[model samples]
Target: MRPMLNIAIRIIRNIGNIIIKNYEIQNINSDYNEYNINLFTKKINKNLNNMITKVIYNIYTKNITFLCKKKFFIFKYKKTIWIINPLDGVMNFFKKLPHFSISIAICIKGKTEISLVYDPLKNDLFTAIRGQNAQLNGYKLRCDKYFQKKNLLFALNTSYIFFTKKKNVNLINLFVENLISLRISGSISLDLAYLAANKIDCYLNNNVQNFNYLLAGELIIKESGGLITDFIGNCNYKNSTNILAGNADIIKLVISKIK
Candidate 1:
């Protein structure tokens, strides 16, 4: 396959088409010029998050693979894979419900290195580097801890957990009780990006794709002054059945409870 990145671009184009065809077409918001690019050579950074699915990309490889998630596209690259969930909340968008997005990231050598998540409906993008800052559109972003709710928003993949053995139910409920609010967004990539943006306090994944598929947001949270690790508190992001990510304080507390 051409490589994950290339597939991501094609997927973005497809999503953009869907959005423009579905909603009123408009010009690109003049918010961030430095973050604008429709090519793969463009600098990959946090600011690229907003234009999540309108980009046309090429990943320098032979053969290409594409997969669609509800209304998104995922691709495969050489020694890497690109997964893009375009239109994360399609149901909400079709119903004029609320926030929806397009998420794209690349996993290289089993680690997340590049990510570009955009909300096509809002034309907002969030980009990130492995060890650098994350940006919203073009402005640097840091996950703020000003949330005062005693039960800060907690996100989980409940649908995926329903099939789990009953033995894990206690652990699930224990985690649930710690948060002030809980949500089940159907998009995993968006869930992690939301954490980087401080929209949510913590997120846990029970059974997701390979670790490489998660590195982009994993590194984003770390770069944005957050924390990430498996159930055992190990920082390894390469191979794990589950992951806990959030701000440093939240991750520590959540990890302590899991132990």
Candidate 2:
């Protein structure tokens, strides 16, 4: 990475910290109400989004290539492409619930070479480099959660089985019977963030398309003591049509049961 790129990333990280703290303080003052809290949260998101856009424009005008989800822009040069998610859990933040996040990744030829997932709610940041250990807030994180599995708390996205041509009712029933509990949180980004914090044990949702899944899945979970793969146990990020994420043992057990 070039020195300028590193400096830009550092600036982005700093701005994220400030925004998270500001939102948290705002929520505290709003008594956790939707009306007032959401307005402030939207303002914060817009501010961050604008800053990111400026950075992207600067990089692009200089002939850099990039990819983005909405306005979370990433600049690419040569074989490297950056993936960014400016606001992960917009609804949660809007409702004064503390679970949203910011995710960024540097992919070299479609493989993540460097990545950062930051949850402003808990002030948790997970960072990783290819072929090296992942870290959570600078502390080494490992995907070992044997004890968490016995009483699993899972998170998933809600969608119809219409696309699958298979009824999910029976599968849902089976999973409910084995798992301790399940939650349908509106945001996949927050779901991964919660998993990293141990607020949730695992996350699985087969209906997710490549668009959203590619951003948050590995940025947070894989970097914070968790694993991610398709339902059939394939680790390829883009090939994962059906996703499963959790601590190693928890993910393995869930995959076995679901398959």
On TM-score, the candidate that comes out on top is 2
State each model's CA lDDT, in order: 0.61, 0.65
Candidate 1 versus the native: TM-score? 0.65
**Per-structure clash totals for the candidates:** 25, 1
- Write one digit per residue (lDDT tens) for candidate 1, span 69-93: 4333455556666665545554444
Total backbone clashes of candidate 2, pairs 3 or more residues apart or in separate chains: 1
For model 1, the run of ten residues with the poorest summed lDDT: 38-47
- TM-score for all predictions? 0.65, 0.73
RMSD after Cα superposition, model 2: 4.7
Say what the RMSD of model 1 is: 10.0
The per-residue C-alpha lDDT of model 2 at residue 112 equals 70
Please estimate how well model 2 matches the true structure, expressed as its whole-model Cα lDDT.
0.65
